[model samples]
Target: MHRVAVLLLAPVVGFDATIAPTLFGTAAGGDGEPLYEVTTCAVEPGPVASTNGFAIVPTAGPEALDTADTVVIPGTRYPPARTGRGVEDAVAAAFARIRPGARVVSICTGAFVLAAVGRLDGRTVTTHWKYADTLRELYPAVRVDENVLFVDDGDVLTSAGLAAGIDLCLHIIRCDHGVQVATAVARHCVVPPWREGGQAQFIDRQVPAGDHAATAATRAWALAHLTEELTVHTLAEHAHMSLRTFNRRFRAETGEAPGSWIRQRRIDRARELLESRDIPVDEVARLSGLGTGGNLRHHLRRGMGMSPSSYRKVYQGA
Candidate 1:
């Protein structure tokens, strides 16, 4: 059986801590045997206070890391005030015990701990999108792609928030088992088996209900005419500004390129069409501004690592 050893830090998010075990343990092989054996290990064997004021007593300590097939770090409240001082020492000792080829994972702000160890150096990684900017600022060596739900750089995987942890665990199950097994685990958990990491984190935003919404109107305008095959030139024209000026201010506010933002909007539209209607694939291409079925397939595979039909099957939510 595959062994998943999770390192439980002080103040751990309890839900994220249980994700791997609950998801992986539910999967079965052809012989009907469980595929993974999950163990929760802490720096110490005794009780530790959780963020929610609950207490946890893990089964094993750092020594168990020496034999783990996989090592996961679940999110916890970050340091400076909320955390105990032993965090650094405990985590360091645990890191030292992990052997090679053992996969490493981080859920939510646990990316901070992984970053602290420098294991994520020069790797494409992400945390909660709200904290993405701060994580990038703190760990300059990390590539820091903030838009996706998670970044899977082979052995090292990092996810965004509590729910995204479920996604990553299911992904691991799929990689270790297959789509069929992962689907079963997701059904057990009552979650979508797969979601495009490229899917927008959130869209709805609220102002103070007083200040004149500037970018809000601009964003709406961009979404209306996605199929027009426009550029920053057309966008700047709508916003009534020169190209150079628009580019600077747009990046300052949205933190993404004009082209990328448009493409993402188009993809979201494509997903909506794919899920809600029986529209043919080529129509999906045209409506989503991807131009043709072949182009749509290419973008879907590159951005999400899945075919359109497969994506619809899981996330259609219909």
Candidate 2:
């Protein structure tokens, strides 16, 4: 089994720290056996208080990092204003014990620890969108892109806040196993197999709810009918609203215009098909409403910096 060690720093974000073990530990192999052996560790190997006024006693100490195939550092609220100035002695020692070639992952502000240790230098990474500016200000060498939910820079991976960690975990499982296993895990966890877009889609927005949740049904219909010819006017008619009102409401509810949202959804669908299915690029494009292979290539390059074939090769593990 893959050994995963979660390093719990003081004032850790309870939700962020537990997600990996909970998700990864529950992940099963084809024969219905656990795939990962997850262990919680700390610098001192004792009860560590969380930011939520609770304490969790870890199972091991820093030495666990030495044997772990993957070392995960969850978000923590450290002292001195949580700035990425320098690594603590204990933290540095733990990092050192992480055997060379072992994957290192950070969730949310846990990127701060990696940044402090100079592990993120010259690497593209991301943290919580709220802390993206701070990370940039502190580490000028790191290419910090706050738009995506996570950055998987080979051995080193960093995810945005909270739930983005789940996405990262799912992506890792997909990378390690395959789409089937990851999709099964997502279904068991009662979450979507994949989110629609990058972290940018989740930026704070005042979305209407209940009866005032205008355009929600139309959006759902559009998602289900991605291959259909969908324009702003069509969506407006589906929502029983004027084109101008629909556009305004779409921006208000989704934090983007209707065309942009539809484009992203199409791109997302295309990516899903590319990763999970063995279909021709032209067929995938037609099914995703991109119309043609050239259109699909253009959008994939612009949105993901990769062609459909390249994305399939990388993500499908083929």
Candidate 3:
């Protein structure tokens, strides 16, 4: 089993702290064995206060990080981390204990801790949207993009606030295991299986008056009919709006252009088919509305840097 060490620095964001363990711990293999061993550790083990008006007692200290395959730092209110002054001596020592080459992850304001330790320098990362400006100002070396739900930069990954932590954890599970396992974990946890990392973060937006003027129904319809050619014009017609009006409304709601969103959905469908079915590449492309095997290859290579066969081999172990 992969070992995961969650390092808590009080006062932590209670919700963010639980996301990794909840999602990773719930993940099991075909034989019903846990896929990961999750341990909650602290700089000084014992009672750690949370920002949520509660405290948690951890069973281990920084030593847990030494053998971890991944080290996760959840949101923390530690002054040095939050202010970019530098990490506390204990926290710095704890980070040093992480095995070389182990993946490093941050949830919400926990990016601050990573940034303070220079782990995020020159790397694109994200935190809560409200704190984007502050983070950028504090650490100009780190490129902060608060618009996305998370930024996955190979070895280091950072997620946006609270609920977005769930998204990132689910994403990690999918990457490590496969779509089926990730989807099963999400089902067990009662959350959506996946959200694209590039998908925009939820910000306040003016809702359409009612069902009549909203693009939600049209979006749902498009998802159900992904095997069909879905063009912006067709979507506009289905929504009973002009092309320009539909485009404006769709972008406003989804933070992506209509054509882009359609293509992404088709790509997502193709990936699911590749992982779950034993069909030929051409057939998968046709079923996913990508037109041809060449088109599927093009999209997969451009977006994921891999061909369909490679993806299948990796996920299906075939």
| Most TM-score-accurate candidate | 3
Stretches of candidate 1 exceeding 4 Å from the true structure: 78-87, 205-318
Tens digits of per-residue lDDT, candidate 2, 1-318, equal 799999999899999988898888878875688878999999995799999889989999998998999898899987632675587788888888989899999999999888888899999998988989998998888888888788888899999899989988887876676566677789988986665324352646554655444888998999999999899999999998899888977776665788878987787678778977899999999999889999999998986687888888876632
lDDT at position 103, candidate 1 = 93
- RMSD in Å for model 3: 1.7
RMSD in order of candidates: 7.9, 4.0, 1.7
Output the lDDT of residue 142, model 3: 95
Residue 129 local lDDT, model 1:
82
How would you encode candidate 3's per-residue C-alpha lDDT over 66-97 as one tens digit per residue?
A: 99999999998888877879987888888888
Q: What is the lDDT of residue 233 in candidate 2?
A: 91
- Rank order (by lDDT, best first): 3, 2, 1
Best by lDDT: 3
By TM-score, the better pick of 1 and 2 is 2
Clashing pairs for predicted structure model 3, backbone only: none
Q: C-alpha displacement of 289 in model 3, angstroms?
A: 1.2
Clashes of each: 0, 0, 0
Clashing residue pairs in candidate 1 (N, C-alpha, C atoms within 3 angstroms): none
